[model samples]
Target: MECTICKMGETKASDITVALQRGELSVLIKNVPAEVCANCGEYYLSDDIADKVLTQAEVSAAKNAEVEILRFRK
Candidate 1:
């Protein structure tokens, strides 16, 4: 796919983690699909995924949930 931002040749689909913040609320999304530009490294997310992420973030923030970072190695 062509990159909309950089207008590069072809972009690769990759899984990206997005961090969102609103007021005192913060949430991190994992494995979000995006088309990344090979040259400029620009990422684009679909509207559907953006909406889902926002919704999840709002729900989590409403509950005042804690954000934890976990690391696993094999």
Candidate 2:
């Protein structure tokens, strides 16, 4: 698919890092599956994966973590 941001490159399956922050909490998830733009480096995650990432971030926020790094399990 064409990238919306760049409007110049097609997206391809790639491994990416998703960084999320909520108030005092910050989470960085590595090795997540995504479709990335070849030109602009924009990444898109499916709704299912996004939900999982949000859940993880919420858990980290609930724990009051200032920063956390996790590997994507799925």
Candidate 3:
């Protein structure tokens, strides 16, 4: 698939880290499956993956976490 951010780049399957922030909360999720742009290094997560990541971030925020690091698991 072509990367939306960098139209010249094609995306490949890869594992990457995702950083998400909300107000004072910061979340780092590692080893996530994504489509990564070879040229621009931009990553695109699938709808299911994105939903899971967001859910994790929301859970962390609900716990009043200032920062959280998590490993993605199927």
Candidate 4:
């Protein structure tokens, strides 16, 4: 795929994490499919996934839930 921003010649699909926010709610998603531009380092997600993220953000906001970011020492 060609990059819309940088007009890059080559792009690849990669797994990425997207941070979504609605009001005071926020969540981090994993293993999202995205087209990343080689030249510009820009990532774009599919429309279906974007819609799903928005819906999930709304639900999360309604529940007033918070996701804790954890780190472990090994």
Better of 2 and 4 by TM-score: 2
Taking all chains together, each candidate's TM-score versus the true structure is: 0.72, 0.95, 0.94, 0.72
**lDDT order of candidates, top first:** 3, 2, 1, 4
lDDT tens per residue, model 2, 1-74: 99999899999999999999777778999999999999999999999999988888888888889999998878
**Residue pairs in collision within model 4:** none
Q: In model 2, which residue pairs have backbone atoms overlapping below 3 Å?
A: none
The runs of at least 3 residues in candidate 2 whose Cα sits more than 4 Å from the true structure, single-residue gaps closed, are none
- Per-residue error (Å), model 2, residue 49: 0.7
| Candidate 4: tens digits of C-alpha lDDT, residues 1-74 | 88888885567998777776656656776776778888988898778867775666566667778762211111
Model 2, position 33: C-alpha lDDT score: 95
Q: How many backbone clashes does candidate 3 have?
A: 0
| Best candidate, TM-score | 2
| lDDT per model vs. reference | 0.70, 0.91, 0.93, 0.68
Better of 3 and 4 by lDDT: 3
What would the TM-score be for candidate 4 when compared with the true structure? 0.72
Off by over 4 Å in 1: 66-74
- How many steric clashes between backbone atoms does each model show? 0, 0, 0, 0
From the highest TM-score down, the ranking of the candidates is: 2, 3, 1, 4
RMSD of each: 4.6, 0.8, 0.8, 5.7
Candidate 2 or 3, higher lDDT?
3
lDDT of 1 by residue, 1-74 (tens): 88777675578898877777777666677777777788988888778877776777767777887672211111
How far does residue 68 in candidate 4 sit from its true spot (Å)? 6.2
Determine which window of 10 residues in candidate 2 has minimal summed lDDT: 53-62
